[model samples]
Target: MIVIKTMEEIMKMKQAGEILAACHKEIAKMIKPGISTMEIDKFAEKFMLDHGATPEQKGYHGYPFATCASVNDVICHGFPSKEMILKDGDIVTVDMVVNLNGWLADSAWSYGVGQVAPQTQKLLDVTKESMYKGIEKAVIGNRIGDISNAIQVYAEAEGFSVVRDFIGHGIGSEMHEEPQVPHYGPAGRGTRLKEGMVLTIEPMLNIGKYHAKVDPDGWTARTVDGSLSAQYEHTLAITADGPFLITKQT
Candidate 1:
């Protein structure tokens, strides 16, 4: 069932989002050549703990990391490895969830390690803008497909493909809640959004086809064609006015 959050609950989630957003900001500044993805994960875990929040993704379903650092061809859920050293021109997507007093906020941001290739930079820019397009459709009385179609239209027109394997989801006390939110679909279909409904609109766009392949580790997903991929995500609530971005950076 789709859960409609009360204003009080939304306020609590906003607090959690503040911590998550801040953590992402700090992670962005540290994204540079010579740093390991594991190092980024460790720093994120410490930052959350210091702020009295928990790294909800750690140990989640046997996943043992504070962040999923997907680098280059990896689409999502790339394991943070000490051996994976970042070099110049590498792009990595850091995805994580933060829990503050039981409220959850999730977000993912793709960062350039150094100067990126022109094509790779365009992929990042298009993916981020597609996410915002989707967010714009997250209003009361709109269907989930409206948001999905917006993302798909924008990314495809920009010469990118939307990943079909992993889609967004409702987030609250639990990491995955009701009302699965896809990034590509027919507009005006799927669940009808309502005020107080909170969900994530994450668009994972690829430079090649939308197909993905999972590694033997069963968590890391990468582009099937070994092409670059990018993603941007935000947890938001449908409000009477419009969509309120819970993970909006200060």
Candidate 2:
């Protein structure tokens, strides 16, 4: 069953979302060449705790890290490790979730570590743009597929492939909720979006093939051919006005 957030719950979720957004902003300032993904994870854990929020990803289904640091070729669920260090020309993705006062906020961002190749930069640009395009359709009366279609169309037109294995999802108290959000396909199908319905629109686009494989770690996922991949995400709420980005301190 779909849960429509009440005014009070929405406000609570907004506060949680802001905390989640701030976490991402904090990582952006701290991430650079030579830093290990584990270091980033530690920062995230401390920040969330200091801010009175819990890192939902930590201890989530045995996931030990507070942040899922996905480097180039790793799509998502990349466990932060001391061995994985950021370097020049690499794209790093940080996916984090914060739970505050029983509410949850989830978001992700892709960054170009140090200086990246022009083509790699373009991939990052396109991936981020695709996320925004998908968010444009997160309005009342639009089906979930509308958002999926926007992402798929914009990304494909940019000459990139969309990962079919892992998609975005509804997020709330349980972390993962109803309405699985795919990043590729036609609009006007799938679940009908309604007011107060909140979700994450994460588009994982690959510079090579859309296919991916799960690493032996049983969590980290990378490109099947070990090519570059990028992703961006935002927590969205379908509202009477339009799609409201709850992560915007709303």
Candidate 3:
């Protein structure tokens, strides 16, 4: 069943989003070369705890990390490891969830470690833009497919492909909820959005085909063609006015 958030609940989620957004800002500043993905995860976990929020991703389904640090060819759910040290030209995506009180907010951002190749930079730019395009359709009276189609149209036009294996989702007290939000689909199909409905419109774009392969660890997903992948995500709500971004950064 799709849960419609009350204004009171939405307000509580906004508070959680503030901490998540701030954590992302701090992580952005520390995304230089020489830092390990595990280091980034540790910092994120500490920041959430210090802010009186919990790193919801840690211990979730036996997942043992505060963040999913997907680097370069890794699409999503990349394990943060001390051995995987970042270097110049590397792009990493840090995905996490923050729970404040009882509310939950989730977001993911991709960042370049240092100087990146022109093609890689374009992939990042297009992926981020595609997310915003999807967000534009997150309004009352719209269907989930509207948001998905917007993202797919833009990314495919830019010579990129949207990952089909994983997609965005509704988020609230639970990490995953009703109305699964895909990043590629027919524009007028799927669940019809309603006011107070909150969803995450995350578009994962790849430089090659949309196919993905999971590692033996069963968590890390990488591009089948070994091409770079980038993603940007935001938890948003369908409001009477329009879409309100819960995890929007200043």
Off by over 4 Å in 1: none
Per-residue lDDT tens digits for candidate 2, residues 167-234, read 98887787889989999989899999998898999999998999999988899899989899999988
- TM-score (all chains, Cα) for each model: 0.99, 0.97, 0.99
For candidate 2, give the lDDT of residue 246. Answer: 73
RMSD, one per candidate, in order: 0.6, 1.2, 0.5
lDDT of each: 0.95, 0.89, 0.95
Judged by whole-model lDDT over C-alpha atoms, candidate 1 comes out at 0.95
lDDT of 1 by residue, 1-250 (tens): 9899998999999999999999999998999999999999999999999999999999999999999999999999999999999999999999999999999999999998899999999999999999999999998888999999999999999999999999999999999999999999899999999999999989999999999999999999999999999999999999998999999988
Q: Which is better, 1 or 2, measured by lDDT?
A: 1
Tens-place lDDT per residue, model 3, 1-250, is: 9999998899899999999999999999999999999999999999999999999999998999999999999999999999999999999999999999989999999999899999999999999999999999998898999999999999999999999999999989999999899999899999999999999989999999899999999899999999999999999999998999999999
Error of 1 at 145 (Å): 0.6
Specify the poorest-scoring 10-residue window by lDDT in model 2.
241-250
Cα-based lDDT at residue 235, candidate 1: 96
